[model samples]
Target: MEKYIDIIKNSYSGYWRYLKHEIISVNHWDNYFYGLIIISVLVWVLEIIFPWRKDQAIFRKDFWLDTFYMFFNFFLLNLIILIALSNTVAAFFNDILAKIGLSISSFQLFDVDDLPKVLGLFVFFIVSDFVQWNTHRLLHRVPFLWNFHKVHHSVKEMGFAAHLRYHWMEPVVYKSLLYIPIAIIGGFDAQDVAIVHFFNITIGHLNHANLGWDYGILKYVFNNPKMHIWHHAKALPKHVRYGVNFGLTLSIWDYIFKTDYIPHSGKDITLGFEGDENFPKQFLAQELYPLNLNDKKK
Candidate 1:
């Protein structure tokens, strides 16, 4: 027993050393999915007012599986943030700022260590959300991307898993494209980025919750779950039922694009595709099914 224990310890020690030099590390981003879990549940309770479908059911198995993936995506994204492009930009900024002056009396190099990271992440999230909102609308309008995107909108019933119901291509494409610009321009660290992802997942889940309650002015700056819930309504082009809120963080882009969708009006919206029989109910079918959208009007 002692020999085996020592062997295990030795192996772990070597692994730690390898990670220290060859691998980037992640911390301060553990259990990050808690925020998302709570919000999603709340939204579920309120889904009755503007459910994607009148018949949307809450399945126990689907609920847990979606929750599991929320945590999984959080952890996985945090891992990427730590190793790939967290502090490289910060170091670069510090070097440039140092050349100008440490404390030039009028203006210091920076307010604090984490200030730029905070502000930079805020801007990145809002901008990317705007991009996502429009891109989503375009996909629905166009034919090709909508096929895959329909995989997400095809869900007849929504729950916490509804947020994760997106076509797998979305995460790979959006994160890679947006993060690259953010890493280059904002000088974010892996830790800070992870924090943003943690918040984002939480908000996404909260938006998908079936809860009720109007958030008031908070709707202007942030895209609440209630507002986002209407987007996944699976149906399109309702009179006085479209156009109001369109952002996860900031409403600026939605306003600029003239595509901002807000449901501030008191019209009850029927969410989900209008008469969509091909929509899958099983969780595995949601993931395993090809993102291919068939023509000929389902």
Candidate 2:
């Protein structure tokens, strides 16, 4: 009990310290706080200058809502709830593993640290993106998970900020699945590879933005706005039932696996699911949406 309490306390304290550093300190290139602001503003400016959906308002419907989700999911939620909770859970998991005498400390399949810096970063990026791709598919394929994922798909007007407008449970699902595979690639420094993280965020922002761009020849390699808009289309293709275009960062996975589907331009396509009109519009309600056991009990 004391150990758990210590873990919670440490998590809260650590989160505050990190948050303070991100706020008061200005590291320009390596700072996520500033990176988020800079990237968001840049993309938003692009949207204003060249919006594919010309009729959509500057402050589009649910624009503020999505912005709130961006900040909430990225920063506040960690401080308020998840940081401590995750630490406690992780501690418990480690204890269980210890009791079983199964050590994950040496789980690395190959040490990326031994390779050249660029090659190591490349390998780490590909493997991590692949993990996320599979996790994104699971969010669509699993019914219960889809309930939480609905918050993201509820977007009627796609924008840059809409990239982060997802249920908090999503990171939990994503990071939980991402842990082991990353552990397998020994000597992974998140700070050292912050560029890759930011790059993915940029791609995610573009994918959700109201822009029509498929990197021509590179369309098969990278996910672009044109290909991703269909992922949110109200109607799914007849051939693909679960969902399509499940790529998070790279389109390569979807193309290789045949999950990629962009039958039309998708610029004016209706976004959201069949019963989205009834989905919660507010942040708090959406956070609690998937776990609404009251509806299930009925």
Candidate 3:
């Protein structure tokens, strides 16, 4: 009982420290709130002016729930889970590497600062997107993983907030996988990572937004709303595979892998899983939805 009490106390203190150090000290909360406001206003305006589905309401079905998901993920889930997972992965890897007479501290592939900013940015973007692409594919292809991933796909209505409607465990899984590889490559410093992250967030929002725009020939390089909307299609065309268009920012991966599934028109497409009518519609329910062990039996 005393040990358990101590553990709880220590965990609370640690979290408080993290909240102070990582969030407050760095002004992450201010930046995130302001950035979200700016993007939200911009997307809201764009949606009103150039909606893909003219009949789609501004405050469509599940909009509030998705908004909750966005806040939950950005403020609580990501902060707690990502930091914990990052530390755990670092410690675990360090211990294993030490046993083998290797050290991440000594690992350096290139000096990122020495490279031109554009070149460094390009390399980070490509590598990170590749990692995310594979991870997204795995989430859809692996049945057990899809149970959690389905939370994101449960959104029947697409919007900017839909981009953030991911399961809480996803960032931990994706970021931990990304850390080791990026660490080894060594050229990407904090600024380079931040730049890639900014582009990723921007593109991710646009890809899910209801704005009716496909970059035409440039869609081959960058993912567009039209291309990504097909990914959420309730039932894909017969020719396309079960899970297609797993790219995050770049469509080049899908092109290379032959998983690109954009047709001449997406007019008839419907979003979300076919049998997801019973999926939870509230934030708390959705958070707990992934933990229901009975899902494995189905």
Candidate with maximal TM-score: 2
Query: Candidate 2 vs candidate 3: which has greater lDDT?
Result: 2
lDDT of 3 by residue, 1-298 (tens): 4544454555556765655565445445335545565677688788888898888899877788778787778767745555555565666778789999998856767755667888877777777889989989988887777878889999888888898998887887788778766775565565456667667777888888888787888999999898898899888766664578888899999999999997756644778885688787777787788788775455
Higher-lDDT candidate among 1 and 3? Answer: 3
lDDT scores of the candidates, listed in order: 0.53, 0.88, 0.77
| Of 1 and 2, the candidate ranking higher by TM-score | 2
Tell me the TM-score of each prediction against the true structure: 0.60, 0.95, 0.87
TM-score of 1: 0.60
Query: What is the C-alpha lDDT profile of model 1 across 1-298, one tens digit per residue?
Result: 4544454555555544644543243333333344454556566655645564445455532566565555544444334332233334334445566888741222423332345655767766665676666655555665555555656566444465667756555555455445434444434455666676767666665555654434677665566655665666645456524433445554556557655565453234555665456666555565555543444234
Runs in model 2 deviating more than 4 A are 294-298
lDDT of 2 by residue, 221-268 (tens): 999999999999999866787889999889999999999999879999
lDDT, model 3, position 5: 48
In candidate 1, stretches whose alpha carbon ends up further than 4 angstroms from where it belongs are 1-29, 33-65, 68-115, 238-246, 262-268, 288-298
Ranking by lDDT: 2, 3, 1
Query: How many residue pairs in model 1 have overlapping backbones?
Result: 28
**Candidate 1: lDDT of 33?**
42
